[model samples]
Target: MEFDYIIIGAGSAGCVLANRLSADPHISVCLLEAGPEDTSPLIHTPVGVAAILPTRHVNWAFNTTEQRGLNNKLGYQPRGKTLGGSSSINGMIYIRGHRTDYDDWKALGNTEWGYEEVLPYFRKSESYYGGTNQYHGTEGELFVSRLQLHGVTKDFIEAGISAGHSHNADFNGEEQEGVGAYDVTIHKGKRWSTASAFLKPIREQRSNLKVITGALAERIILDGKKAVGVSIRQKGKSRQLKARKEVLLSAGAFGSPHLLMLSGIGPAEELAPQGIAVLHELPGVGQHLQDHPDVVISYRSPDTSLLGVSVSGSAKIGATLWQYLRHKTGSYASNCAEGGAFLKTDPNLDRPDIQLHSVIALLDDHNRKLHWGHGFSCHICVLRPKSVGSVGLTSSDPAVAPKIDPNLLGQEEDLQTLLKGYRMALEIIKQAPMAKYQLQDIYSADALTDEQLSEVIRARADSIYHPVGTCKMGRDENAVVDSHLKVHGIDNLRVVDASVMPTLVGGNTNAGTIMIAERAAEWIMQDQATA
Candidate 1:
C-alpha cells in the first residue's frame, strides 16, 4: 500500500508526527516501528521501569565503545524499542531544557528555532497539571503531573534549600537554575507514553493511519537522492513500502544516522568500510554526537521508604502491587528518579551546566547489577558537555547494530564539571534533613583529593540516556538537516528526532523532541497546502 507519508521509528517524535499528519483523514500515514507494539502491561505501570530497563524485552540496550576516558569501561545505552519509544520505558521526567539551548540553535544558523518560536509548540503538546499558564498548556495530547513525593524526596529538597539553593516548585517554570521536584509524564499513576497520548487513542478511528509492528526499516529507497520508499524486514521476510509524497525519518539519534549510513547517505569513509555504495554523501550524517555524561554518589541507608527487596520489603511490594492494581497508587507508581535539581556550577553562567537526580533506590550500572540492603543514590550529570562522539556503521548488514563511540569524557572540562557536581551532592547529603537517615558513603571516602575523585568519576561515569546530534540541524556544512528538518542533500525526506538536535539541551530530550515533532507537523501540513 502506498502512503502519502512513511514515518520510520514510532518514538517520541514519530508518534506525534503520526497523530498530527494523519488527523487530516485524507492523508495516508504509515508508521513503521522496528520493535513490537506497546502491549506489555509493564509498560503502562510507572514502576515497570525496573522491569523494562535491565532487559532487551522492550529496550535496544545498546552499549558504547570502551572509553579510554573511563578506564576502558564500556557504557550502557538503553533505548526503548516499543511503540512509545524511549518515552515508554524512560524515567518519565518532563524537561524541555533551558531556553538558551534553543537560542543557541538559532544562533548557529537555524531559523525559526529560537526559544520564543519553539515555546508555542512545547505549550501546544502539553497537558500541564497546574492547568493553563503562560509556560504550560492544559488541554493537549501529553499529560504532565507532579511526582508522588516520598519523605526522602522531601528531605532531599529541604536539604537543597539548606545548601543555599532556591526552592523551585516547578522546574519547567520561569527559572531553571534551582532545586525542585520534576514534573513527569504520568497520568493517574501510569506512564503517559507518546503512544498512549497520541497514537493509541486515534489508531482505530483513523482509517488513513497504519501502524506496523515488528518491522525493521533497513534502508530508504533513494531514487537519485529522493527518498521514495523504505525496504523493511519483518518475520524473516522482506517487503517494500512506498511513500508517495515524503518520507519522515524519526528513527532517533543512533538509528537515524545508522539508517542514513546504510542507505549510502553518510560519510564515504564510513560506507567504504561497510562495502555499501555511496548514494548521497553527507559527511555530517553520524558526527557531532552529544550526551549527558554522569556519575553517582551512593549512600547505604536503612531507609525502608525507598524500593528494596528484603523479606519485609518483598512483602511490602506484594501489598503495593495489589494497591496499584486496584487504585494505581503505591510504591509501585514511582518512576524511581522522582526528585531532581538543575543548578549552575558557576554563578555567572547563563544556564545550568549540571543536573542532579535523586533516585529512591540504589540505581547503579543502569541497575544491571543488584545490591543487597536498602540505600539511596544521587546522580550528577554534566549537561551540555563539550565532549562529542560519533555513530558509525560496523557492517554492511542492516540488522547489525551501529558502532556507538560516545568518546565519553573526551573533554577535561566535562570531567571537571562532574567533579564539582559530585562534591555538591556530597554536601547535600550532609545536610540536616537527610543526615539522620544517612549511614555511610557507600561509593567513596570523605575529603578525597582531586586525583581520587577523578578516578572515581571515570570508573562510574555513564550515559544518562540523552544521546543526540548525529544528524544535527543547522545551516553549516557539517549539518545533516536544514532549519526545517529536511536532509541537506536529499529530497522528499526529513529527519524528525533527537538526532537533529544541533546541541545537547540542558535537561532531558523527551519534551524537546516532542516539541520538535509538534512543530514539524505544522511545517509538513503547511508544505502540503503550498504543494
Candidate 2:
C-alpha cells in the first residue's frame, strides 16, 4: 500500500495526525496501530480505564530496570497500545502543564516552543467545557471537561485550601499554583480519548484516510538517509507500505526512539552490540529519558469515603455502578485520583516542584497489591527530578520491550523533594476536611520518623506513567530532532509525540502530547503548502 503520509502508532498524537493530515481531502494517510481496535466497552467509560490499564492487550505494560532508589524494584510503566494510545487508558487529566514548562524548552534553544507560541496549538486541539477563552478552545477536535467532583474529591480540594494552598479553579488559566478539580479528557460520563475526540468524527467522512489496527510497525524503510516507508507485520504476515511524502512517527517516547534504533539510525556503539546493523549513527536516539518519580502515602479511612472492600464500601460499589448505568452519574464517573494540588516545596522557586494526587483508594504499588478496607491515598511526585533515565534495546526484536531505566531518585535532592511533598500531603489530610474522614492513620503517623519516610521513599518511588525525552528535540549535539520536530539527519521523517519533549512537563503529559501533535500537524501542512 502507498500513501502521502504514513503514521506509525495510532496513539494520542497519531490520532490527531490522522485527523488533520487527511483533512486536506487530496492527500492520503495511513495510520497503523499495534493493538486491536478499541471496541471494548471498557475503553468508553471513565471508570473502565482502571479495568483496561493493568491488562497487556490494550497496554504495552512496560516495566523499568530495577531502580536503586526504589529498593531495587522494577517500576511499572504502562503505555497505551490501542488507537488512542496512553490517552485511552490514562487518568485523563487535561493539564497543559505550567506555562514555564514550554519556556524552559525555549530556554534550551527550542525557540519555537515558548508557552506563548505553543498556546495556540493547545487551544486549537481542545474543546474546553467553559467554551473559548484565551487558554481554551471551543471549536476544536478534542473534548476537555471538568470532572463532576464526588464528595471525597471535593473534600480533598477543601483540605488543600485549608492547608494554606491556593484554590485554583483553572490550572490551565492565569496561574497553575493551587488545588482544584482537574479538567479531564472526558465528556458526558465517557472517556473521550484521542481516538474519540479526533478520529471518530472524521473516520467515515475521510475517504483518503485508512486506519489499520493490529499492525505492528517493525522498522522504518529508509532509502539511504530518507525514511521512505514503514515495515509492518500483521496476522503473521509482514507487509511493506510506501510513503509518498512523510513517514511520521507518533509512537510515544519509547516506541519512537526504539524504532529509530531498529532502523539503524542510532548510535553505532549501541546498535552493533545489539546485533543490529547500523545505517545511521545518531548518538542521541535513545538517551536523556525522564519521568515523574512518585511515592504514595496510603492511609486507611474509617469512613466509607474511599473505595475499598469494606462491607459498606462494597455495597456502595454496586449502587454506584447502577447509578452510572442509569444516569452516568455517581462516584463511578471519577478518574479515581479525582483532584489534587501542585505546589512548590520552596518559596523562592518560580514554579511548583512537586504535585499531589488525592486518590480515593489505597493506591499502593500502582494498584498491584490490594489492601483490606476503605482508605484514601495521597501520591506525591517530584515534578522536576535531577535524576536522568535512559531507554535502550533489551533485544533486537521489535516484539521485545525496551529496557527502561528511569533512575528515579538517582540524585539525593530528588528524594529530599519527595520527602518534603509527603510531609505536605500529611499536613493537608491532618487538617479539618480530611481529618473528619480519617479513623486512624494507616501507618502510625507519629511513628513515621524522617528515617522511616526515607526508607518508604526508596521502597515506593515509581513513575506516574509520564516517561519522555528518549528522542529529545533541541539544537544540541545530542538532540534527535530539530525545533520543527524533524529528525536531525533524516529526510521525510519526523517524530511527533512526547518523545520530543526535551524535559518532562511540570504536570501530566497527555495534554502536552496533544499540543505537540497539534503543532506537528500544522507544521506538516505548512511545509507541504510551501513545497
C-alpha lDDT values of all predictions: 0.91, 0.88
Local distance difference test, candidate 1: 0.91
Worst 10 residues of 2 by lDDT: 438-447
Per-residue lDDT for 1-531 in model 2, tens only?
999999999888999999999999999999999998888777878877666666675888998889998889888898888889998889988888889999999999999999999999999988889988898899887888887786788888998999999999998999999999888888888889999999989999999999999999899999998999999999988999999999999898899988888889998877898899999889998899999999888887777757777877788889989999998877677788779899999989999999999887776777767778888888898988999988888788888888889899899999999988988988888788876775455553664788888887787778998988989999887999999999988999999999999999999999999889999999999999998
Model 1 poorest 10 in a row by lDDT: 438-447
Candidate 1 clashing pairs?
none
Q: Each model's TM-score?
A: 0.99, 0.98
Tens digit per residue, CA lDDT, model 1, 181-223? 8899999999999999999999999999999999999999999
Given candidate 2, what's the lDDT at residue 153? 80
